[model samples]
Target: MHVVEAPITITGQESRPQIRVAPPGPADRRIIDEDALYMATTTKASPVAARMARGTVVLSEDGNVFLDFTSGVGVTNTGHSHPAVVKAIQEQAAKFLHFAGTDFYYDVQSSLAKELAHAVPGTFAKKTFYTNSGTESNEAAIKIVKWSTRRPLLLAFTHAFHGRTQGTLALSSSKAVHKERFFPSMPGAFAVPYPNPYRNPFNIDGYDEPEALSDAVLSLVEDLLDAAAPASEVGAFFVEPIQGEGGYVIPPKGFFAKLKKILDGHGILMVADEVQTGFGRTGKMFAMEHFGVQPQLTTMAKAMGSGVPIGACVFDAKLDFAVSGAHSNTYGGNPIACAAGLATLRVMREEKLVERSQKMGDVLHKELEALQTEFPRIGDVRGLGLMQATEFVKDAKKTPDKDTRDRVIHEAFLRGLLLLPCGKSSIRYIPPLVVTADQIRGAMDVLRASLKAAAT
Candidate 1:
């Protein structure tokens, strides 16, 4: 057992979190009211009104400092306003801000593309398309596969979230609320079970076994393709190695390898969505590295530019659009974003954040597992590296306890810790890769206190 050390007080430093006033103070309330009146009703995780952020902390308008465990929903992998990234952004902005890469050429644009092509998994000659968000990357990937293969159908898994755009929204099946009233999603999208051992949909012998779960999911896909969607028309299989919004669910070992075999047999391309699992968040530079399965194409965003708006769709060189202007985007690969991306990648390599994530992940897993032993509500703790989650359950039957989960989130906020809920009944912890052992210890302590307060 990893012994619990004394709680570390991360304060006094400019980057460390320190709460002066309780959350939702006068200034925060004023901003919240203004936002509620002006902003759309999409959603708000908490009433926090952030004034500034540095590293793993956010300073709110309420004068409360918070340990940002959410990492802006997994965007700030290198932490908020990393010095190197800011410097690169400033330098690049001074030279040029925007020059449409689709029409003109920029060194930073192609340079970042080359760097990404080399960094992405797979040893084949690769090409890249830049976009502005994860959804746009998925959109580009969808077009690339369909155009390259001349196939119309695409396959995604249940509880999967690719993006919110029209084409990618059709691929997402994480929540009906996300797609509600936005009917008529893109055509020729199909869904299959994703082989989650913790919550297996297939009722088979030894369902909890990785191999058994893998076999069942593959068999289901085989049957579905045979009966519903034709294999000949399927363009690609879009998958997230670690399901992000679907509760940080990690599939069983060898699952993607088997899935790849099926897709390859059908002459279908595999599109790996690394939106939330890429850029050193998952210990490896890419989550696909963990499974040893090489994707023909990969869509990346979120942490690609360490919070800068940059997304990339990388694929084997052999795959190309059918014609000129088949797919292009304005503001893709702008100089400032590219500079930020280049600098972010440099920091990742220099600081060895990937290796740090792996080592610290071991400590985090041990601590969370210890929590599971203490709290009956913590039904499961699963994920890779810094992207981890704890599921809340109500009874011995393991039913979802969303009430308790919401309470914990609220209580954690009251205690100056920021967290986000994923899936139906789980809290995801995806702190920046720059986090330390003391910070992790502090987060776990806050979670413990929150759980206790919520239980009361």
Candidate 2:
């Protein structure tokens, strides 16, 4: 498998090539003003309006070429407008755009389902149900878990982000901002402590002694179950193998293993939400594989379709459930989207993108660690594979300095490097898996400069 080593060029121009433009030009300003008038201000908007994108570059209406570290909030893993994915979508569209599998049958949908059932980590036979987005997929997982176990309560973790849907919002513990206006969320959802070593509730130190922290988290789970509901009443425990929106929080080793043991003891199913960590983002095809523990159910999206809207809830086949009308979606298994997903998976395998993500992650981690050593504001630098983050702090005590983090992100954006801030005061650096080592280094340089500028 040959990885693209040369800097990506669009239309014969080198990556990050300079482009002339008038700042906040007519097109950008007009669109921004129109958007503010027509669209709800629920979601935050970036300064620039995107015109077009190729590879890891997002060309804005103002003619700025920004190296997209966000990847459309971690959706474009195969990179923007990947030729193979584009070709598949176009070819599929020529044949049929939407078949509405709830009403009709489609080969593409079945093929994608079979592929996911096989690809997701597990030795047992699995079944899959599709959805339009990550939140929908998570919502579907919740229903499946309840139906399979005949239980109502679910166990989630602190600082975990499931999604914004009413049902998912109930499980998400990231921030109040996403749930402030929304009330009366889905009930029977409980929160537990995630094994975050940095702000560990146990106050443990260092990665070398992860067992103690793991024990504390496991104990908390047991205590929560005892207080809230009985073990049999809990349907499943939803966990993001690597917390994407939660500062890329990678739990300690043996954490999941121990948690899995407890859930198994109580006959509670484990549901791994790989919405952000799956599809080679974490180097492995599935993040749960790193723990050697198979989830009874799994949810995936984001990179699964390589920027297309698609998600899946997969589960062990042995779980008793009816397919007659248990759940359905209008565009869940759209043929065109399925084709895009199949092509994305093919590209990942044939191009060895997972291996590339792992290799590049090593280089990125080392470089970021060096920056952390130099910057006092960089309190912690941690991640798995390509899903990485550097948390800003006011001092060595790890006090969250959201202002400094925001400044760093803003400065990097102005310098043609786009970054996404996650958790409280952390900047998540999740670039495309197709990104080259040099691109990673270039982005790092921009971040380093941005941190320095923001410091003063």
Candidate 3:
């Protein structure tokens, strides 16, 4: 299969979001109405109906051009329908569709796995188990760690979002609504405090810096393990290198290394959930690289396939399941998904998107920091690379201002910009890695105007 050398450029003003009509226009409104009647309640993320999406902008059925900062919740890392990825999908589709990788041999699956094993952090021989989504990857991690270590207990941080499935839902603590009716999740999962210097729960002395905060947090975990959960029974501590749904929270610089040390001392494993942080989203190939720690198991999805659905659990080769049928998915690592993944990885490397993300993240940090200075409501602006957020507060006291956050999002949406809210009162700005400097500035301009409009 031949790879495309350049992006498929859309000519004229159609390249970017152009608003010929306000979103939810007559046609969009009709579709939205029918969708509400037929689709599941949880299916939609915004009111605007998207008919087509390309690059950093989405074309709403109403003819509005929306700057998609959400990037389908960080899935389209290479931007929507990246030319290379599209080409790969088309070529693979022509050959064949399914030949289960779990049960049968497939060249694409092995090829993609080899690529990922090399790319994912680890000095030892590594292996990969493929799945269809982030939650599935997390479930695989849970299984691999448990089966390998013969441990019964698992640990996760508060505000952590592993997935919506029962096993991972139990690991999550981002919101009660995600688990309101689904109780008795999986057994033996415990939640611990995730150190956020901006919102310190322990309030330990000298908690201002990340190092001290992580130390205190680790101490708290040790105390809990001793007093409550036993460390010997704990299989692994699953954590997002940077918390996503919990408000785009970035832990202090030395947080992961320190946490890894404590876990190592206990003979417990560290599992990095890179579903949202993988594929150069955080300026690194994987967020764990930024932390200077290699996890025994790492779960990835989101941008792994660019826009295709694929997830994987990368772990030490030593952690493979003993039984062949112990865990397997029919659709996992199918030829098409693997082909898309291979193309996505190639595009990331060829485009040098990782370095581009770092440069763009600096741009976002500078832009958002300036906004923070101008808007006292913006209590904090934090994140690395393209994954960043602005936490709004009521005043200098730093009380969460969910109302303003909501208003700002709606206003931005009205103005043809899309932003997602996380952790109650924070707006997460995760534009596609392919986004340009001018696009960032343009989105910021829209945000600034929206903030002013919401204020009035």
Question: All candidates' TM-scores?
Answer: 0.96, 0.94, 0.96
Candidate 2, lDDT over the whole model: 0.85
Candidate 3: tens digits of C-alpha lDDT, residues 7-69: 333321232345667666897899889988988888355688877788888877766778899
Model 1 spans > 4 angstroms off: 1-17
Which ranking of candidates, highest lDDT first?
1, 3, 2
Stretches of candidate 3 above 4 Å error? 1-17
Model 1 compared with the native: what TM-score?
A: 0.96
Ranking by TM-score: 1, 3, 2
RMSD of each: 5.4, 4.8, 4.6
- In order, candidate lDDTs are 0.90, 0.85, 0.89
| Clash count, one per candidate | 0, 0, 0
Q: 192-283, model 1: which lDDT tens digit per residue?
A: 98887778787556788888888888998899779799899899999999999988999988999999999999999999999999999989
Q: Flag the better candidate by TM-score, 2 or 3.
A: 3
Q: Which residue pairs in candidate 3 have backbone atoms (N, alpha carbon, C) closer than 3 angstroms, thus clashing?
A: none
